[model samples]
Target: MGMTAPARWLVAVGSLLALTACAGTGGSPGGGTQRQIAVSTAVPDEPVTLTLAYTDDPPSKALIEGFTKRHPNVTIKPQMTPFNDYVKSIKLAMSSAQPPDVAQYNPGAMSSLVPAGLVLDLGPWAKAYGWNDRFPPATLETLSSDKTAKRFGTGALYAAPGGLSVLGVFYNKSLVKKVPKTLGDFETAMQQAKDAGHAPLSVGALQVGGFQIWNALLNVLGDVKQYRSWVYGEPNATIETDGARKAAETLTGWVRKGYVPAAANATADTDAQAEFAGGKSAFLITGNWAAAALEKQMGDDVGFFLMPGPTAEPPKVASGSSVSYAISSKTQHPNVAAAFLDYLSSPEAAKVQFEAGFMPVDTKTDMGGAGLPVEIKAAFTPVAQANGIVPFADYASPGMIDKLTPGVQGLISGKMATAGFLSSLQQSWNEHHGS
Candidate 1:
């Protein structure tokens, strides 16, 4: 019997990707012999055409533009979507007969796609391109399955990273000069801001923004090794733990003291960004992704601090995750898609994305000359150099967003107790993910 329509569609995408792999065998992606192998595999006459979808953000644009110039024959038609509706758009697009050749996807969404056999395996091309050694182990960790980090899960490396996306502290320059390193210092500073008649800390818990607060607290109070379970595990054991309550209590203090803005809980993302940019608040807890946005508004007037380290504990650390590139299972030109992936991680392409307002994940490529926002490179660079972990929020399913984000809004709104908040999270995780 012939395959079902969806199954045939899957086969078609896989075959297209494999068809490209079959044509050329030598050059790899990471440089040296890999570059030589890629060059020797030349199907230069073949045109690579792909459709990609992602949030219509600056870094994404810069990456796409750079990809085009490096391989003129390979063209990428980007299907940009608004941040609020991007997931929906991607879901719709992926279900179509002509899905994008590559698409940016979160871990859970990707996992779902993996089971459907919608995403192609990149192992063959990863080997052919030598991304095996070209990319960092951490990045490969995200691209790979939880089962193993050595290879792209499902045998194909469907995704590659654009940069290291980290979230932490963003603060106003005109409002505060010194950044606090420890939790105690942070408390003192928050008091100082309050005493000075300013909102000591600005938190925007609107809709899905609450995830950051939970993660930021964990960043300061939780144990590093066990944090992953807080995000991925099903038992919901984390909410009942000490770190969870401590983290909640710290945030509650900020709310009760009127250190957080009156409208903070109601405010969406732009509220915090605008407040920091305009100097309304002393500090904004956010991510490196906000670096470029702040640069345009605050320039040298902005700075960052890692989420507070333990008062008697180690230094405060920011959270980070690997940026990656993904190929469309529906793409007609797999080799061309691979070529762009190669260019993306290349020194030249890395500079383009870096200059477009982000820190490049490619260690070999120096972005110093790219002239990125000075405040970003100056502030977060040190914390990143100090090394931190990627918190649970970005790694888990969108369903997790439904759990923690609202809990955050409830916490800020005085609807939930610290213990209640943590207990809720524990219960929700177990109900969904399972113990």
Candidate 2:
């Protein structure tokens, strides 16, 4: 939980030193396993430039700033892109004789990229570090490769959790003084808002952005009752089984009742955030990551609740890992990379992110008065503690979004039946990824 001076340097700088060397030979200025980084305390004989490539919101910048302070010789450079385009960009980057030393990637879809010979297996590093004893079971599974060996779930410990995540309703405190804590209460509140001439909930759907919310609903109501094939890849998202039917029916009914925005399918992430922040909608289903954004925008006016099911106590919630950091098998500096990962788990780094508006992946670490994002914490922590958590959108395959999202849009718009929509989902996934 504490940090030594040397550990801090690797945690910060090593994460981003993505400068490329020839493809087959990854040896850096100081030859070491790509996984182990020299402790920041030791002044490097010379500058070691490391390049890290990942999506736009990468922690590379923060890491670089933190790491370089301790090790003047270590310089971290970033190759950042949009989240949607990250998969393609990383692949292109890794293909060159020069590959990024470290990167941030999605667990489900991005793991498929591992087969390209770009990823370094973290097995040895993991054994040495023994995160198995420090982290939770689901986390290892959640942050690990993928769900099935038939797919991309296991290989090496290429990546691990970088932040905390949970599921629940993000609602406008100013709009609804009292939040709905139970399913009946939530539904009644939605109806009350409609009668009072305000949109009760705002969700993105069929649009490029809204697909995730659709899956969130599935995890909460659908998976809680019936067997869900997509969660384990036993069936798939498109299968019109009981779980799929129930999920679709619940969402469609809400849509027909005018609880959510009609055109939410086209709403972008920023737009949805804005609408929720502006108080145009009473509730937005989300996790803890949104805490920082909301705080900067609205401050203390918003509140949160664990989404309730149709049962007795607090409802089972939906949750998944938000993002993870991984080492490049192609990096000449494996030790540096591994050392950086160790730095990330340190209380110092965890404290920085926690106070900066994120959750700590290490449960033992306390927030250093930076305060956990209340809305997110309220929504997800109970579910996680109760062992009711599940995987995120890309849990099954990289192809899920394209196959299932559009059909969800149709169901939400009242153009498709619950059963019919689910039937189409299975067919679509097969069409794209093949059965």
Candidate 3:
């Protein structure tokens, strides 16, 4: 069977993208001769060692352990890089002569690798392992893209998601008496929190935390298909729209209403998260990646919810990303590497992925734990089932995060108008994908 509609819808939402391979591996993704490499579902019986480069911790380390445990003859060594440095350094690492056999995907810093033919196209393995049915189509879609890496969805299978994440609201239940039922109620709660001498929202405007807030708002307020097209790099895609402008205005209004802290622009994501966990803020808007940390800090006082919409009933839309992996064209063991990728969606791996604070690749798998994790899984189920999760806004272009962080910072500081912000984003997109 072909990819499901939800998978097709998420073609543009690349995340934790494995976009590179060692150079001189195969033909370009744009229609060049594809390497006729063989694939297999089994690893060799002899001793084998594969090196892995990644940034995320819990899932990568634990998943690697789980996979290696099943096949003692295989030893997978791991190299962990910090996020910012990873973005700047991964391209070089993957392009080096002795690149890791497998590497985690990071779209912004690694798009160049795809066009350079430095990454393996896993079409054969996907076909062999029947990944189309084993993993979520949307997760697979997030990794597949054209040769240019500018547009995703209808292209070679490059990476497979090891874990999934979705963005939503994390509230301090001790402070929010009633969870908001609608967008208006959400605003009212924030206002009350502010009036009661609490910061309504703790924003990390110094980095991605700023745009993440705007992104969550747009997920609820904007037209999903239009936003998806823009992120997907479809020709003529544009962020200049009524929904985006309204989301921007909504954020600005929150700032003026004293719901957002005055020092928001100065705060970093960790600091803002700390503020919320410390009970200084009524709510924190972020992804499930923070669930483990927050639960450790606040225990039962913390709760989770998707950002509400204008009506009592809200759309299930949310921005999400994945910790995906790809094989290198230079690997001596293509079949063995493919085996590791294929293991990602297994029931055993699902347990490891869930315990690592990510939504499992097998969305249908029950996350059999309790507390905040259970709450997150409960909130995430319907959205994943509906295929409502889209990629973060920065996935729109290689340098889009540079534009997003400062653009949303301007919105929070009242230094940038909505028109200018949208125009600037479009300018970046046009530069990368053409107007």
**Lowest-sum lDDT 10-residue window in model 3:** 8-17
Residue by residue across 110-225, what tens digits does model 2's lDDT show? Answer: 44445444565555555545456544445555455431322333434557666556655777777777867667788788888778777887775634344555556666566542
lDDT leaderboard ranking: 3, 1, 2
lDDT of 1 at 242: 72
Against the true structure, candidate 2 reaches a TM-score of 0.80
Every model's Cα RMSD, please? 9.2, 6.1, 5.8
* Full-model lDDT for every candidate: 0.61, 0.60, 0.83
Per-residue lDDT tens digits for candidate 1, residues 153-210, read 2234557777766566777667777877777787788788888878776667785455
* Tens-digit lDDT track of model 3 for 102-204: 9998887547888877788887777655678777676777788888898877688888899999899999999997989899999999989988989999999
- lDDT score for candidate 1 against the true structure: 0.61
- Name every residue pair that clashes in candidate 3: 16-105, 17-105, 17-106, 18-105, 21-118, 21-119
* Regions of model 3 farther than 4 Å from truth: 1-34, 56-58
Sum up the clashes in candidate 3.
Answer: 6
**Per-prediction TM-score, please?**
0.80, 0.80, 0.91
Leading candidate by lDDT = 3
TM-score: which is higher, 1 or 3? Answer: 3
